[model samples]
Structures are given as structure tokens and as C-alpha cells.
Target: MPALSPLCLACAAALSVPGAAWAQAAPVTLKEVVVSGSRSERALDEVPASVDVLTGEDLDGAQVQDIRDLARELPNVSVKRAAQRFSGVSPGGTGRDGNAGFNVRGLEGNRVLLTVDGIRVPRELTSGVFGSASFGRDYYDLGLISRVEILRGASSALYGSDGLAGMVAMSTTEPAELLKAGQTFGGRVGLKLDSENDSRGVGLTLAGRPSDTLQWLGSVQVGRSSELDNQGTNTALNSTRTAPNPQKDEDVSVLGKLVFTPGGGQKHTITLEHVDKSSEVEAYTGRTTSATSGSVLDLDGTTDMRRSRLSWDGRFRIDSAWADELRATVGVQDSDSREVTHEQRTVSPTQRSRDVTYSEQLWQGVLQAEKTRALGGDWSQKLVYGADVTVSHMDNLVTGTGAPSYERYPLKRFPETRETTTALFVQSEFATDRWSVIPALRYDRFELKPRNDGLYPLDAASLSDSAFSPKLGVIFRPASNWSLFGNLAAGFRAPSPLQLNNYFENPFGNYRTIPNPDLKPETSQTLELGTRGSTHGFQWEAAVFNGRYKDFIEELVAVGGSMFTPADPLTYQAVNRGRVRLHGFELKGHYALGKATNLRVAFGQTQGKDTVTDRPLNSVNPAKLVVGLDHRLGDWKLGAALTHVAKKSTSDIDTSGTPNQFATPAYTTLDLSASWQVTPSTRLSAALRNVTDRKYWEWTNVRGIAAHSPVLDAYTAPGRSLALALVTEF
Candidate 1:
């Protein structure tokens, strides 16, 4: 209805070309049903928080294979993946730990909750000193996913711990999604290729309904790839080289589901899933310096990761006064990761090796009930209550050969530990003609128990903590097309076993890490205000939030101790800091030009600081702006997106670690995508990224690198690449 930005004007001009094919007229709308916001199906406009949804069609059209690629479409969301430059003795580098995790707002790692089908994913291994191994949390196959919902803000009132920042909920494909009316059997097969990583993959999915009450679905994916490409020019070996390391990777994933409806309003579904991935890397940069004697000849590393899950979900429609419907879910998941390093030495013509492994087995159950009733004329209320329990057993082992005399092999940094959490939550919403109010609360208790196997420390510590989270939201609608909302929410995170009982003693280095039994859980409070509306084929939302955190945990903080003392080495322990504040704002909207064309824009900026130290938080991402245009004609669709990222200034970076932190420069990139419906059941899509081939580095990928690093190009993003996919239904 009104004038737009220059980019939108350009897009409008392109859509008004003289000789353009015309397609059917369909009015554009933004009315999607979402469940993550309130644990019940509701229109996206009704949700008070900031939520984003991606459907299967969106994933297919974008050719997004990993979390890093998925971040490009969302504002204030990023995933970190560093180059592979780590070797023996330095195992926790970002290069070795790929796809670290999701960062929402300004918090990352365990602060963000990731789940699939209401089942929680395992946390990453984050032992700083005791265990030098870092394992990532990307363990899902994109081919099996049908929908993804990202809720940005505090979510502890509905979920519980580990919801300090936000939550990511993914739902797998079901048999009904693939089957048509009266069709008994249906499925699809897809093939994918990407030049950025030199990877090729294939996926096959099939669903069948043998009986009126029985249905089954099965899917499998397999892939192989080499190291990701970069703009580096040097190909020589050593730390000075800028080229990517030599690496090989393989991945396999399988999923199976069976749905049964015996009678009445009862439905049950059983699921089984497994994923395995492995990689081998040649770390030429880890070689000894040229001036050193008895220098290393060669270094190589191998890593393997695996996860398995079994789950059962049931829903019943019980028409009773107390409850209108009930749902129950029970699941078990196990994850394991192992890393090995081999070092070749020339002094004695000997070889050294290190092997480390970490595993977690979890069992969880949930029961929930929903009720809806009318209070008076034009007034109604809905209530949802749930209870959940989770138990996890985590263990780690380390063994090495040809180690230093002072250091021994087969040692455990922390004892085997078990973690348990029990929670109960209730949420209610009351609505009138022009206003709606929502209130929710949750109570949780967590405990950590450790069992000593007589490896490292005789007396380990156990931690027990409890917390309560509360949330309130209000919405006011003055007209049918516009609404304003405000929300106040609380969140918390329990300390992990590794952070409570990590113990290590290095005699030669005269340093040790001791456990902190009195560690406190992290907590936060968030206030958000926003308004969203749609009119004249245009939809938009603008929101700003301020979050305050307390008892922030810092790992491996140096305490008072002298390394010269033999009996008491320099002690490092996990400690809690004072206050932290994070504030940000986001603006996003999409406008439909006509029946076949649309233009969109999204922008986000965040700022955070440690109030106690008065230093800027390094976890906050730089400001970003993205604009896109899409058009469809007949059976073909074409789209283009432009992204601009602001520079990370030196004043914002914390220079405590590296005084000369490398600040990322401002950069802009453009991408083009097109899809063709070749046949009735076949579709082909391709994406060309970084059309300008401008070399640049992403702030998330190069946070800790020094300003004077010789191999800066290794941290650069892929210059130019292409991704292609083909899907066919049977």
C-alpha cells in the first residue's frame, strides 16, 4: 500500500517486465498453525513470542543440508563451524569440533535447547582442562525432518532447564504426509550434491498402509564428503599454510516409525532411529616448528560419533469434565563420541597415540493433559498441564601410549555420573473479545550423583538444586488485522556433572583443576514487547527484548594458588560471576507484489555485557540485514537473496585471551536459487551462493583467532559454491 526500500523497489521493477509468463492468481497469506509456542496447535499470529517455522518445502527449495546452512534464513541465529587445524595435545580446538551448536540471542551451547519430536538431544562434552576433547551437538539428519520451529526467548516455564535462551523443536515426517487420498503406498527419493564441501548424498523414504488401522514409514540416508573449501592459496604444510586440511567424512542415518489405531479415539506411534558419522583428518599444521630438534614428522586424527533412539507416543481423546484430551510419551536415547590422535616422532623413531571417548544414555517420559471450557458469553479459557522425568548416565575414558613420564595413561578426568530431573508445569490462557492473558509456571528438581571407580579422586562431590520458573503474557487487539503483545519470562540451567566434579592434576606442568561442589545454577529473566499485523497482502513484526542473567558459570577460572608448591599446584575451578545483561531488537516483514511475486526483509542487532566486569560479551553476533525476492511462473520458481553483515569492532571484543583479537570486516553476499518441476512427480532445485566470490570470514567461525595469525584465510567462508538436489515421488 505504501512505498518500500530501494531493494523492494528494484524487485517490483523486475516483476513488471514486459514479456513475463503469468501463472494462476493466488492470494498470499501468513497463517501457519504452530504448536511449540503453547504446546497446542494455534495460529502463528496468536503466539506472543518470536517464533519462526520452516516447512519441508522450504528446506527442499533452499537445499539446506546442515545447521550452518539453515542459519542463513533466520535472524539472530548462527551456528559455528571452524577449520580443522587441531592435532595431538590440543583436542578442544574449534576445527576438531564441527558444528559446535546453536546460538540464540547472545547465549549458546547448553543454554539453547534442541529437541526432536519432544525428545531432548544430548548436550555437548565441555570439559575445559580435565578432558581436552570437545564433542559437538549436531546429530540429526535433515532428510528425515518435516518441520522445524524456533522459539526465541526464555522458555523454561514450559520446558524446564536448558531453556535459558530459546528452544528448537523439530518434527519428523509421518506416513500421512506422504500418502494421498485412497493411496495405500507412497514415498519419495532424493539426491543431493554440494561443491562447498564436495559432498554427495542420497535419501530414500517409503510409507505404506497395509491395513485400515496400521501404517508404517521408513527412511535412510547416506553421504560422503571431503574437507570444506575456502579461499586459502598456500598449499604448503605447517601452521603458516592457509589451505584447508586433508579430511574425509562419512555419514549414515536410518529412521523407522509404526502407527497403530486400535479403536475409539486412541492413537499410538512407535519410532526408532540411528545415526553414525566418522571423519579422518591429516593435521599438517600441528607439526613441530622448523627450528625445533626431534621435530614431529606427521600427525593424524580420527573421530567417530553415533546416536540411537527408541520412542513411543500415544494420544487419547477422553471427553471428561476434568480433561478433554491426554497425551503420553516415553523415549530412550544414547550418544557416543570417540577421538583418536596419532603422532609420529623422529627422536626415537617412535609413535605416540591418544584415545578419548565420551558417552551418554538417557531415558525420559512425559504425561500431559489439556482442557478447554467457556466461562461466560464471548469469554473462554484453556488449560494445559504436564509432568516429565529424565534420567541420564554419562561416562568418559582416556588412554594413551608413549605419554610423558609424569602423566599416566588410562585416567578419568571425572568419575562416572548420573543426572536426574523431575518437573511439573501448568499453563492457562483466558481470552475475551479484545484481550488475551496467559500465565504459566514450572517447578523442577535436579540431582547429580557420581560413582568413583578408583581412578583419579577418592572423594567426589554431588550437587542438588531446585528452581521455579514463571511466565506471563498479554495481548491486545484493537482491530482484526493488528495486535500488540508483551511477555515476562524466567529461565534457568542446572550445572552439568563435569562442571561440578572435574578433577585433574598435572605434576610436570605444576597445575591442577579442582571441583567446585558449591556451584550454583544459572538463572535469567527476560522482558519482551512486540507488535505484529497483516494488511493488504503484507505481514510484519517488530520486537525488542532485555534479559538479565545471574550466577553465570565460568569454567576453569584461575584461583589463588602457587605452582611452585609441590603439595598444592595452581588450582583452577568453576566459579559463578555476578550479573549479565543482553538486549536486542528484530524487525522482519514480507510483502506480496502480485499473484506471482513477493519481497521480504529481515534485520537483527544484539548487544550484551558483563555488568560486574563491564566488558562486552563476545558471544553476541554482529548486526545483520537480509533482503530477498521470489517469483513463480507456471511450474518454475526463481529467488534471490542478499545478506549484509556489519563489522565486529575492536571495542566490542574481549581482549583478555588474545589482546589482538581478529575483528571480522563488514561483508555482503548474494545467492540465487531456482527450481523446476520437470514432471508430475519430479522436482529439481539448484542454489548458487557467493556470486561475487569475495573472500570473507564469519564472526562466529573465527572468534578466538589472533589478529596476526598467519593462516587467516583458513577461517574464511566458502568463496563460491553450488548445491543441487532432485526429488521424485512414487
Candidate 2:
């Protein structure tokens, strides 16, 4: 990694001046905005909860490549990489896998739902019934992203079930003002060169307006990365082992959007997007001990994924006595992933093969209307009503020739499942001269069904179930610069198809799992209070939250044998569990030091516990902190950031009463970047990550090797790397 240039350092110092602080003041007037969480457009100050908006400019200035990198700049948001061998766990090349998951206020999985143009993406499946799979943190080509909006805290009141954690809405690019004015079509072409990773990539984006009432935008991006190498000699701490040569990947995506308006009415837009990615890599398996020799197993695999989406949105005004605005949206998404695995010993001569495939389709429709009227003197009221429906179907298949000969069953089979949900919600906001109040509520009904295709006749696999969840919240503004908000929301998650119909019975006795049709839905209630305000040169936000979970569904490990034979067999099945609780706090703020400089800091911590056993919940995140400084002068901009992650233990545990714990030591990393405007229409930027090149493990995971052996080490996240690119628009 390279150090910050001398000129950039001087700019940083100048921006730290006291006079620069005044720039932090909030504007006195409010602007109308359409946020995804609301049914219709409204004033930002009138929203009931904390919301953060990151414009495209912010993304460009920060050199953000994907959602994971963007998370580092937000308050109370943390992204952690998982152990090496776990890389292939995630279905798509987007990078969510076992190593990548985002924690907001310390809750992850289905809790934090992600959406693009209001379409929901499916959650990943894990051993626990909790929504642990995170698709947001993974790599999605950012060349088409125009802006990102984050709504923090429980939002079941607006988004329903998956909103137990929070929500992230990603908005894609639209025709720019220049293009709409017919001055010229605007576009950018750029290439990135990385030093440590020995990788190079390029991308292009273009936008234009065809006529006064119609606009169009399109983006295409493709990138290929070379194999990544670790930095340390100790393979255990290295980002990659075996001379650092296995991790490599490639990605390509194209997005197009069209906007239309009937000369001065409301706006209507439609979008079509497609993303395809494929990658192959070899990852380390922790050291293993054998009767003959100690060696690691090389886990080699290939993965491919394709995703497409179509959506339409319209905003119109209705001249009615009660209603003033109406907004409607309809969307559909299709995704597919296929994975192939080949395992071999690094030192010996043997090979094994396995394959798995997953396919999903989702359709959704939404309609919302809001009306604003004068309630009384110095008071105004806005009422919103909306309804939404979603249907999703998934198919999963697993096969391999690796199963022991005695257990050689059908080579392949498919398990199918489906889920549907419908919801209706309403919210009201009232404002006075110096104060404002908002109250909102929603009701949701969800249904799930699964059927067995006779793959396993003995596993009675047919079930249907449904659940209803409700939510409430309020916000108050006591002063022009201060706001207080609190919310109490309930969330529900129905049992998935895999938990109800999929079953495997092995008479040969190696491993087995039986579906439980009687599984119940998991439910949770959350309470939160927060405040945001600005002072002199500083702006800040602080929040505290707590949640209680009931009927949590968890996978339990059971040991058994074939009914006709005596053999040890490991089995896992879903089971209803006792209660669980989580509590956390978050703080983030920015201070304007002087004319050209600014400082930002954020911190978060969370603790989770199981009521039944009085034990800590697995995968709970440790405390984390991030600090950064930015400076801009004339045609140059420079920035630096440092992130610190506290030490935490892995979740893998054995029966010896002694836990198989691995401590992930705390580490701080420094990053520096600068952008130089070569011309008014062109710019060049370069950035370096992990400047210190310090070796550290990201997170822990289970290894297939013997416990306590050296061969059991998995790969760590990437080490030091540098990237540079150029952009031009006309």
C-alpha cells in the first residue's frame, strides 16, 4: 500500500480549522422526497424514523465499489469477511457467501432486507432458521447504481416481515440533466489496476434523453480479477496459503431504464436489469492430521449465477376531496445459481466431486396513496394507505458420487417450495410550528407450502401454514435542529420449504436429515429510541434498541443409526426453541473542522443471549469503530480512514466441555485515496486498502479436518491491495 501524498496531507490540516465547522448546520427549509419506506413522497423532516441518503456524488467521492465497501461509511453498520474455505457458501458471485454478512445494530440475516426498485431478493438458507443469508454485502456491479438509501431500525411497519432488522434501497441511474436538455449524451468509461492482487478491470455507463417526455439510461460493466495471494509466512494468518494462488473471479452486468412523463404531470419509470457472474477458486482447508502424514485438503469449486429484474413505477396526482397523490409499483425477479465442487489432497493422490443447484422466481405488486391537508392553524396532516403482495418459488438439488458405496442412492433429485405474502398498512403525520408527530401501523399475512415429489416416500412431506404480524411507531420534533423517534414493531418469519419437505434417509449411516412439517414460525418484537441533531459545526445521531424473540426455530444436531443396523450417524433437523434477547447501541457523527476538511466517526456494539441455557448466541458481532478525514481543494480531493474490529470467538464447539474456540484478534487498517480532476469533464482516482499489510483472520468457520490439527486452517480475507481508475462524462 502507498502513503498519502504530502499535498493531500496539507489540505487535510487546513480543513480542520474552526471556521469550517459552520458548514455543518442543517438547512432551515425542507424538501419533498420519495423514500422507499413510505407509501408516497413527503418532506424528509416528516418521516417517522432515522433515514440516511447517499447520493451518487458521495459514492464517487468515496470510491465505493460495492455495498460491502459502502457499509464502512455508514453509522452502526459493520461488514465482516468469513473464514477462507467458506467462500463458496454463498450461491452467487456477489460475494455474500459464508465470509460476507452485514450486521446493523448487531442483527443480521433476514432482519436486514435489501431491495432494488422495490423488488425483494431471496434470503440464503443456513442451519439456523434465522435469516442469516445476506445478499446485500456481496458484489453487484455498481456502474449502474445512482444512489443508495438506508432506513435504520425495525421497519416491519412499512416493509413487513424481513424488516425486523432494517432496509436498504438501491436506486439505479437515470438520464442526467445535461442529457435531458439535449446538450449531449453523458457517459463514463474507466479502468482499474490493482497492485497486490495483480488484477485489472474496466467498465462503461451511458445516459441520454430521446425526447422532452422520455429519457433512457444504460450501463454495462465487466471485470476479471487475478488470483489473490496472502502476505504472511504463517499459513494460519495468511489471507491465502499455498504460494497465494487460488482465489479468482469474473463478473458482467447490464442495466437499462426508461422514464416517461406527459408534459408536466407526474413521472413514470420502468427498469430492466440483468447480471451474470462466474468464478473458480481453490481455498485452504484448515490443517488436518492423518495416521500417515499431516496435510491440508484443497477445496476447489466453480460457481455461476444469473439474475434479471423488471419493474414499473408511476407517480400521479389525483384531484379528490381527500386524496392528493397516488403511487404504484409492480416488479418481478428471477435468479439461478449452480455450483460444482472437486476436493483433493494437497500432498496425496485422490479426488472427490459434488454438485448443487438453486433456482428462484419472485413476483410483486404494490399500490399506495397519500393525502395532505390543513388540520388547523400552524398544523398540517398527511395520511398514507398502501397494499402489497409477493409470491416466490424455489427449487434446490444436490448430488454427488462421493457418498460411501453402501449409501449410493439416486444420483440426483429436486425439492420444490413456494411462499406468498400480502400486506396492508397506514400512517399519519401531523405537524405544528415547532413540533411534528407521526404514527404508523401495518398488518401482514404470509403463507408457505411445500410438497414432496416422492423422492423420499417415507418422509411425509406436505404442509401449509400462515401468520400475521403488526407494527407501530412514532416520531417527534421538538426543535428545528432536534428530532426524537421511537418504535415498537413485531416481525414474523414462516418456515421454509427445506424445513418442511426435504428429507434424506441413509441406511448405510453417514449423515441424514428429516424435514419437520410441524415447524412453527419465528416471531420477534423490538423497541428503539433515537435522536438526531446538529450543533455549531457538528451533526450527530445516537440510538439504543432491544428485541425479544419467541418460538425461534433452530437446527438441532441428533445422533442416530439405521433402523436395521447399528452405526453412528449425524443428523440435523429444525426444532422450536425458547426465547432470545438482543440489546445494542450506535453512535455516529461528522464534524466540519475548517474550509477544506471534515472528520467522521461511527461506533456500534451488540450483545445477544439465549434465555433457556443462559449462553451467548452464535455469530453475535463484537464491537467496532471507524474514523475518517476528508479534504477537497480546487481540482483535488483526498481522504483517509481507519477501521478497528474488536476480538471475537468463533461459533464452532465440540462436546469435550472445552469449546473449539478461535480468537479473531482485533486489527486496525488504514486506507487512503485521492482524485485529481484532469479536466472539467474527466477525472482520475486511485485508492489503497490495508495500507499496513497486516495479516488477520476475518471470521471463524467449521473445518472438515481433525480438530486441533494444523491442516485445518481456512483462507483469510484479502490482504493489501491498490486500485486506480479514470472517469469521463460529456
Candidate 3:
């Protein structure tokens, strides 16, 4: 089938001004503003892309404490959660790594960009001897976030890199957001409890305006939790155990911001943030007796992560006509992850220990400007230009006392590498009453400079690359209540430092990973068409998108040699693969059933395949349909949500692992929630999740698990659970 030529012609026609009356027709007003879609505040419907915004109230009502919880509320978004079966010698990707980042439109990991307050978040890391260490990208505290915006589809035209699939932007709360009119000081305290994880949490936020020009805000959140519950019932101490391993978790997050407005058309904000999370696990599955010949007795492990960031941001209303506003931001961030494992065996060595640590330090700066101009005949245009520069240093170390002949202690998996990226972008929007055109372009240059010390691998080398991203969007409003939009965008992701220089060799095992300095960046192009309308208290949106990705970086592809050749270890290198095609559609709407009641519905489905091999992509999520109903009377609100998921068929899976993978069955779940305003400044919310206690597994979580494993039940999601929260403002 050919592309939509009519839409293409219409977009081409949009370049020339249409003879439509501007003041006669009024577009539908949603009254909701968003910034991530276009890097400027605009009506939600005005953005020519698929975007979802979750406000603080939405987060509080849903009890979204982490990224895993947040995924339940969005369509075409998923987070992979493996079982707690990781060991010191094996930190498999399918094992206990917590929430392993997000998958949007079948693309995940470092392909998606995540940011907070315009500052980039650190990428996920998983590299060491035999992949024994891993770090995820869940360093956010929902309590301090005022809003989160998700932009679906390619976004590299604006963000430069790490936006090949999508972007998640978060904005923290401001002092004025919590303060009432004329109030000098205000704050909120919150307490939450959830049965799914047996977790307890507390959050405190304070804001004060000492003077007219100065305002400050501070927030702190703390949580303590145990292992998450699953449908598994077995409590055995060996590998047959179906229940979650005994675990303890603790986390703390702190944020501070100061805003100053000296009345010279300028405002400046200083921000300080810190987050720390730690977890300990007792690997009962690794415990065994000497008679079993398991060669192991006990195993205990702990993982610790910490991140700190400081930044200054300035916004100014420039006097020049061409540049109406100017914005500048500079920041420094540091993140560290450490994993320690101890094993006591019944074998000759008796005891073994492994300690691994990874760290990343970054400095970044951004400058941006925006302007709006009026053309003749009621036509108008807005221009946005920006520059971004970032420099980062990363290093990883592994030390162990497991005196295996082939294993050595105190070694570097990847040498210290300095990464730098510089980019410039410009976007323009031209609009009239009936039509609008948006075009954007960005250029980025990235360089990786490795410190070639003694730890550096002789075969590894530095790398430099560049990319150009561009996008075009067109919107045609045929009626006052309707909008038809089309967009074509390009995105790219540069290869990671570790992927280009990682060096690992196990002579005894006769397998090793070689560096690939010639690896190219992954690139993608997406075409989307959609329509949105509002009428009679009903708002709806439907979109269809097709994307093609090329030069996918496949890590650890067998390049030469054989595993049986001890003298010639099997060589595996990162290489670029063929093309991938993914297409999907989403439908969402909200309807006002009555003066006090509302109904919501959303459905999404995606299909992906390797164009060369004609094989289905396992990262693609199955179809999902969600329905919700809400009613409010006075200060009490009641809501119910029903979710139905399609089953994963055998054909959709790529079961080539040592243990064949299983297919998930279809399932449906219902949730009920209620919120009551007990007092003028106090509120309470409660939710009953998985009301039916149905047993089901998320495809992303069990993608690689053994089909016939006795612990299959361990991969099932939490059965019936309850969450409660209380908040008070003063």
C-alpha cells in the first residue's frame, strides 16, 4: 500500500497561506497547557503530536510512587520487571533488575530521553564480568514532581539525541504552586501505605515567600518497603521457590529551589536535588545442602544507588523585537551505583565475594530563545531556537575474591571515558485560523574520548559521530470542533561509551566481547496522522503511526572464532543490524455522562518486525484497552477502572534462549478508588487494585522466563492489593 497521498498533498498545500477567515472560527479550547511537545507553552490540542500530561492531582489520586506504577495509567507504555533471581555470577537482563527502564513503541533503554526540570537524566548501565551488575533509570520521587509530560514518537529534532522513540519530561513543584493568594507561607504533608509491597512512605513539602522578590521551596520524601508480592504460593528455599525472595528496600529523596525576580524582566531559579535508594536481598533460591552437590550454601546481596544535581536557570524577557524571551540553564549532576554480593559455599573455597561500582559525572548548559511575529491577513508565526552542550565522564570497576582460575580480581570492565555532545536546533510554527505548519531541524556532534591508561583495552578506540534530525507537522481544522494533524519526524541515538569500548574475556569459557569502534548510531523515521475533536462535552483523539528504524545496534553478536577453541576465544562484537518497522494506533476519549459523572476510554496496539528477517519484535506490547468511570458529589469522588489486555501468541515471541519462553494469556482487571475531602485542607484517598485477584503476567516481565519452570507463578503480577494516602495542607 502506498502512503497517504492526500494527507501529503494537504501538508504541502499548508506551506502556502490559506484564504480562511481567522476571527470568524474559534478552535476548541481544552484549557490545558503543555510545554514538552514544542518546548513552549501551548494548548494540549494545539501540539501536532501525541502527548500526555499527568498533574500532581492525577499522581496523588492514582498513588503513582514510581515509574512502574505510572505505566499502568498510560497507553502503549510498558516497564519490564523481572523476578528476584539474580546471583553474583549472573545478573541476567531477565532477572531481578527492578524496573528496567521504559519501552515506548517497542524502543527502550537508552533510546528514550528522560529529563527533570530541563536537565537530562543519567542513562541505565549494565556491564561487568558476565553481566553481574546492573543499574536502572528509576531515580525519581513522585512527591516532588508537579507535572510529567510524555511525548510519543520521535523527538530527536528537538532534543538532539536519546529521543529516538520518545521523551519523558518532569517539572518539580514551585513555591507559588502550593501557596494561596496573598499567603506568605504554605506546605503539605503526606503519608502513604501500599499492600502490594508492604511499603510505607512519608512526604513533606514547604514553600515560603519571605519578600516580594524572593521565594523558596523544599521537599523531602522517604520510603521503606519489602519485596513485592506475586501470585506465587511456593515457599521452598531452593530454585523451585515460586514466592519472591526475602528483600528489604529503603529510599530517600530531597529537593530545594530558590527563585528570585528582581523586576528587570528577568527571573532566576537555583535548584538542589539528591536521591538515594538501597536494597538487600536474601537469595534463598541459592541455598542448598552439601548432599545436593549445589556447591553453594548461602547468598546475600545489596545494591546501592545515589544521585545529586545542582542547577541554575534563568528566564528573561528580552527587549529585542526578534527575540521576545531568552532562557539559560547550567547544571552539574553525579550518579553512583554499587552492588555487593557474598556467597558462602560448601565447596573447597567456602566463601566468595564480588564488589562492583559505576559512576557518572556530567556538566551541561543550554541557551534558548523564542519569538512570535504577526504576518499579514491574520497569519502568525512562532520561532524557537536553542543550543545544548553536555560533557560527561563515566567509569566502572569490578573486584572479587572468587579465586576461579579464569577470573581475576580488581579489574575494569570499561576504562574511564569522557563523552561530549553539542547541538543546535531551530523550530518554527506558522499558523492561521484553519491551518498550521511546523518545521524543525537539529544538528548534533558527539565525541567519546577514552582515557587510555593501563586498564584500557588495546583493541578499543575512541569514537566521534554526528547526526541531523528534521521534522514537519501540519494541522488542518475543517470545523470549529475538529483538527486533523499529520507529522513526519526523524530521530537518532548515539552509541554509548561502554558499547564502543567494553572489554571482557573468559579464556576458560572460551567466549569474549570485543569493542566496536565503528558502530553507527541508530536512526528512525516516523510518520503519524491523527484527528482530535471536542463536541457536546466529549473530547476524543485517534492516531495512527508507522515508523522505520535503521542501523539498530545489536550488542554481542558472534563475529568470529568458536567457543570450543580455548586458544582462540569466540569473538563477539557490537554491530549494526538491518531495518525494523513498527506501526500502531491509539484511540482515547473522555465523555461527560452527566453534570457529576464522566467516562473515559483508551485503546492502543502496536506491531513490530525486523524487515530483513520478518520476525516479530518481542519488545512490542500487546493490545490494551482501558475504561474508567468517575462520579463526584460534593467533596467526595468515586472512580472505577477496567483494563483488558490481549494475550501474547507463540508466533509473537522469539524463544531462542537456553530455556524456551512462554506465552502470556489474556486477562482483565478492575480497580476501584475513592477520595474524600475530610476538611478544608485535608484529603484522603484509597484504591483497591486487581479487585478480582486474577492471576496474570505482563509480557514485558516474563519475556525470557522458562516456559516449563516450576516458578512460573513467580512472574505473575500482584494479586489483590490496596493503596491508601492522606495529605494535609497548612
**lDDT of each residue in 552-669, candidate 3, tens digit only:** 9887788999999987889987789958999999999999999999999999999999897788888898999999999999999999999999999888876665247888999999
Global local distance difference test of model 1? 0.84
TM-score per candidate, in order?
0.94, 0.84, 0.95
Candidate 1 per-residue lDDT, tens place, 491-550, comes to 889888778877777787688888889998899889899999999999999999999999
TM-score of 1: 0.94
lDDT of 3: 0.84
Identify the leading candidate in terms of TM-score.
3
Q: RMSD per prediction, one decimal? A: 9.7, 10.5, 4.0
- What's the TM for model 3? 0.95
User: Compared with the true structure, what per-residue lDDT tens digits does model 2 show for residues 1-730?
Assistant: 1233332243233212232112222223335464754645555555655667777456772356555567765656656544334322222122225224456665676667777777876665543211112222242566667677777666666777677667777777777632634454677776776664565667777777667777778788887775554543444322234344356778888988888887545888999988777767565432233423424355566767778899999988664654566789999888877666665544343554556666778999988887666644675666677898988887765555454354333322325667788887766655566565555555666666654554444444554544344444556777778788776666656666666554555555556677776777776777778888888889888878888877776654463554444475666576777577888888888999997999988888777777786777654666778899989988998989898877764432222233554555677888888999999888888888888887665432322222463422334445787777777777
Q: What is the lDDT, from 0 to 100, of the residue 187 in candidate 3?
A: 98
lDDT of 3 at 305: 86
